[model samples]
Target: MVRSSAPLRRLGAELRRLREATGRTQADVGEAIGRSHTTLVNWERGKNKLSKSDLVCLLAELRVPADVRKGLELLRAEAGTGTSPWAVYGLPDWLRPLISFEEDATSVTTFQPVIIPGLLQTEDYARASHATAPQLAAPDNIERWVAARMRRQQRPRNDPHFRLHAVISEAALHLYVGGVAVMAEQLRQLVKATETDNITIRVLPSSRGDHAGVANNFTVLHFANPSADPPLGYFDGPLGGHMVSDAGDVAAMVTMFDDLRAAALAESESASLLAAILEEYQ
Candidate 1:
């Protein structure tokens, strides 16, 4: 699928701000209008284009002020006028919005059922993870991808306001992506990430059996500016990935995050587990 055009993305961003102004969840507006939160999410993220009538109804439902609504109408006309540079970097079209969303997010809560989450991965671990994929065999391209992943990690670590709450499964820790040394380093990195005040790490033990996030990995991104953007939910699975901004969908994802966090080991205990596993590699 083609990545959403910049204009469409702008339209989405505007709609997001309006929704934030109203202080409503995508689910809340979706329910009132008998639409799914996914619809709202896509619309705001620019993945799903909004039509004239749909826009009319949505803006009305959101109680968008007349003057502001007029500006949005103009933005809608210019939707799909351009593209994102990430496409040139070999990133998939579908993955673009996720990267963009992360750029603007103030806080992120991620649940990973297997493997460490991307932002926390070391270069070797990332290479190994990608190298295992036969489809992405190009070494140069892999490096580009790895470099991009590393770039994504920078702001979250340096920015005092970027909060990351990552929940991993015990299975992920045991599964060696790179060799023993690489895995060891990755484990150490996971432990090191905890040192940041804004970063929180938890582990869901295999003994727990089943949990809310067992099906797939998902993330809920919270924007700092309520008037400019609202919370959105993103899912990564077999069919690329999906971004959901509906109040209902966002709420459901939030619930899932909470449940998974509850089932996961406490931060201190998770660190201990990492330390214990780190020893085996040593």
Candidate 2:
């Protein structure tokens, strides 16, 4: 099943906030609306959208002010309309939420321990990386995944307001993901990407040994309207990935990201190290 779209998630979150303000449990609100608590839970979680009448009933049950009701109606309209740009890639259910969150985020920060961060990967590097997975080894699957990634990369490259900071492991530079030529070009592209003011790339030297982000790769998305939609944390896995929404967990992820950045080399030094490794590949 497809996950909720970005607007739907925001709407759900806002509804949840209003419901909490009224000090009513889901069961209480569900009973008042003659719907099951489970149904209300789904609506509040963004797993399912409420109908217009249902939204009206919910607002009435919560006794929300007119201004609040108007804003929610607008959000509901946005959630109900249009298709996301990534809809064409046929991305997996679990991956769609990540794309949706990234698309709406004002800035993104990622800590990569093993390979290049997705938003900074070149086409060849991405294809080579995806080819290693048994499920994505097919030519069509590789191409589709690569295309999705490339399209996603455009946000950080083209959107002046969208900023990206990538903390990469030193070992990633020597991994030779796509062999000499591909890896060379990938590094060259990484070097070129640093020339843009919005993109900052740093390397966490292997010498830093056993840091805050040693376990796996993770990405954090920060929005312009943080009060309505707080920061989100995500980590990929064998099946798909998991979105971190709990306030405490998201806070920890942010702290870990800060530590990773501190452990990494400065931008200029990272660039110098990248150049040194590129020489080895040549």
How many steric overlaps are in each model, in order? 6, 0
Q: What TM-score quantifies how close candidate 2 is to the native fold? A: 0.85
Model 2 alpha-carbon miss at residue 58, Å: 4.6
Tens-digit lDDT track for model 2 on 1-282? Answer: 233356777888888889998888999999999999988876786656778899999999899999989999888877754455666777777787688778778999999888999998889999889888857456676788799999998898889999999999998888978799998998888888878999999999999989888878898999888887788899996677888888889899899989899889999999898888888888
Please, what is the whole-model Cα lDDT of each candidate in the order they appear?
Answer: 0.83, 0.85
Name the runs in model 2 displaced over 4 angstroms: 1-7, 18-42, 45-54, 57-68, 136-139
Clashing pairs in 1: 26-247, 27-246, 27-247, 27-248, 37-246, 41-245
* Model 1 TM-score, 2 decimals: 0.74
TM-score of each: 0.74, 0.85
Model 1 lDDT at residue 207? 96
